[model samples]
Target: MMSRLRITEIFYSLQGEARSVGWPTVFIRLTGCPLRCSYCDTTYAFQGGEWLSLDEILRQVASYDCRHVCVTGGEPLAQKACAELLTKLCDAGYAVSLETSGALDISVADTRVSRVMDLKTPSSGEVSKNDYTNIEHLQEQDQVKFVIADRADYDWSCAQVSEHDLTSRCEVLYSPVQGKLAPRQLADWILADHLPVRMQVQMHKLLWGDKPGH
Candidate 1:
């Protein structure tokens, strides 16, 4: 029997966030997340999705004819077969990336796949789920993202950056929650402190506004 994964949806669109942002990419959003972040946007992926075998998944991705592929979730790592999927994508020669909640063990991922892990902020209400141990495993190509929703979250995020010396290990990304925090305010705070992390907004959201498949 072939390995199968619970897939939420798979579509071709511009990479929305992370290092690959703005590039035309294929998104493989998996089903089921263990944590419920307060500002979750892809809540639709929490449950109810179709299951596809590895061959079928790769076939659809090939049909897209794009070079960049992002394996994201409702915590894609929640599925045992997700690691295999990442490895298969890499073996197929796609510039693959994985968008995962930092709550899970990222060590299981393929080294070739860029890991875009998130550190849930205080405002997200699920900050406790962060597995800080994953930081040590970060490759230079990996990224750590902080989804800021308020001043408290921003300050806490800065503290994590300092405490972990994250910049020295990998690229750090600072993103403001869609409405709770103004993009300009987050930008000003980063400038005021001269934070080295890259600031990014949800480009897809700005273009498509919560529309799935992008």
Candidate 2:
């Protein structure tokens, strides 16, 4: 029922690291977060942003004329209005996805939006904030991402994948933290274990190289 949200940016870009990777998508980045991961890329979004009503947001998104829309954050769910925003976006007929940190409860999200949930690994420095209960809410349309920074993080992710049967529940993603763990190392680990998960690199980061508003 909320009418407005704090928004960092709304832009058109390629789907970065999810199943929709490389597809042209419209990204709506909401402002604020409660957890700070070690390899956090959008620290600039943690603060100051423009506050716009839901209608205004829809106008911008519609301007892009793209069918794929991603609602991301500095933790988009941190804002009470985000759920309403997501629901409205879906109502507007876009194929909407939410990129959220695992710390928040996703029970309130509109079912129409696909969720790309990031499960914080040990090296993220906010592992304790992960709400493992969120696993029960995931459907095959959703995805779980583990950004690994080292061997320990990789092991922890592999264990979680097995313990929860994450691959069967939804798409399981493993991405190496930029500059921390090499893609080849993570790929080798997945290959050795025969882990049923997808490996990906951030296509936007590759194209833009850490620049904001990509």
Candidate 3:
């Protein structure tokens, strides 16, 4: 028999971030993570969760009758079976996206699923854990995100964008860490510097729900 995945929760909400932002999407929150990113909001998923089989997961997802699905986690890629799940979701015909920290190999994920990967910023404390090799795997449908918490993080992210030519590889996202960096300030920097990236403020702008999930 195949292994059951540890699931923190599954719920429906408008996607709070990324290109699929504002889409009514089912979020599959997998349990566990390896890195301790300082600004993580989903620390609740780090510990206890219920184990769920993929078939049951699909059944619950279909119950929602939504066309979009986002498989997220404390770190979704932390679970090896996540790839299998992604493929199953895609095969089932739901438009799927995977939100992951750029600390693991992304090549294993199904090509049909869009990947929204994060490159840890200095303030995240997991910057050094970033696997630069993953850059080469990014496709046009994919995205690279940098969660900025300070001016230093912004500057460092710009350098990474320039050094890697990230915009040409895929869409680059610059998101402010709520309460740490002001959204307007980040927007100004992007404009003044002429940074080729998308500036997203999910809570301030995109979120129709009271709070973000996963």
Candidate 4:
């Protein structure tokens, strides 16, 4: 039997986060994650998903007729087959991106896939899990995200950005943890610090109020 990947959810919707926010995109949320960040919103994706082969996933994605595809997870990189999935998507001629927690070795991922890596901040509790080596894997097309929950997290993220020179490597994004830090407060901090990183809100959360598979 051909091996298949465990998938938590797959749907077509507007890109609700990162630099691609608001763009029509297809989301492939894979199951399982090793880390449990304090403010994790998609904890539901941790378990209970159907398994599907790469070809089957592509067929389903093609039915959406959208060119932009985002393969995300509870940490999609945790599954070895995710790399294969990304390769297949690129071979199929779709603009693909992978949203991953920066805790994994991303150097093995296909170069054609833009990596949106999440660097956990101090407040996330999973901050120690960040594999700093992933920083070297970033390219201009890739992006780094820091979800800040408060002033401490924001400060830590700023330090990491400067220390890693992430702005030159890829687009840096700083987003406030919903209901934890006010968006306006985070915006003001970004401005005051003169940080080059882009400030973003969870656009889907604003629209759907934490609805799943959005």
The 10-residue segment of model 3 with minimum total lDDT is 203-212
CA deviation > 4 Å runs, candidate 2: none
**Residue 137 of candidate 1: its Cα lDDT?**
91
Deviation from native of the Cα of residue 178 in model 3, angstroms: 0.3
TM-scores across all candidates?
0.99, 0.98, 0.96, 0.98
Decide which is better by TM-score, 3 or 4: 4
**Collision count for each candidate, in order:** 0, 0, 0, 0
Question: Which residue pairs overlap in candidate 4's backbone?
Answer: none
* Among all candidates shown, the one with the greatest TM-score: 1
Task: Point out the worst 10-residue segment of candidate 1 by lDDT.
Answer: 13-22
lDDT of 1 by residue, 103-138 (tens): 999999999999999999999999999999999899
Model number with the top lDDT: 1
Model 1 regions more than 4 Å off = none
Q: On a 0 to 100 scale, what is the lDDT of residue 115 in model 2? A: 95
Instruction: Quickly count the clashes in candidate 3.
Output: 0
Between prediction 1 and prediction 2, which has the larger TM-score? 1
TM-score of 2: 0.98
**Can you give the lDDT of residue 102 in candidate 2?**
89
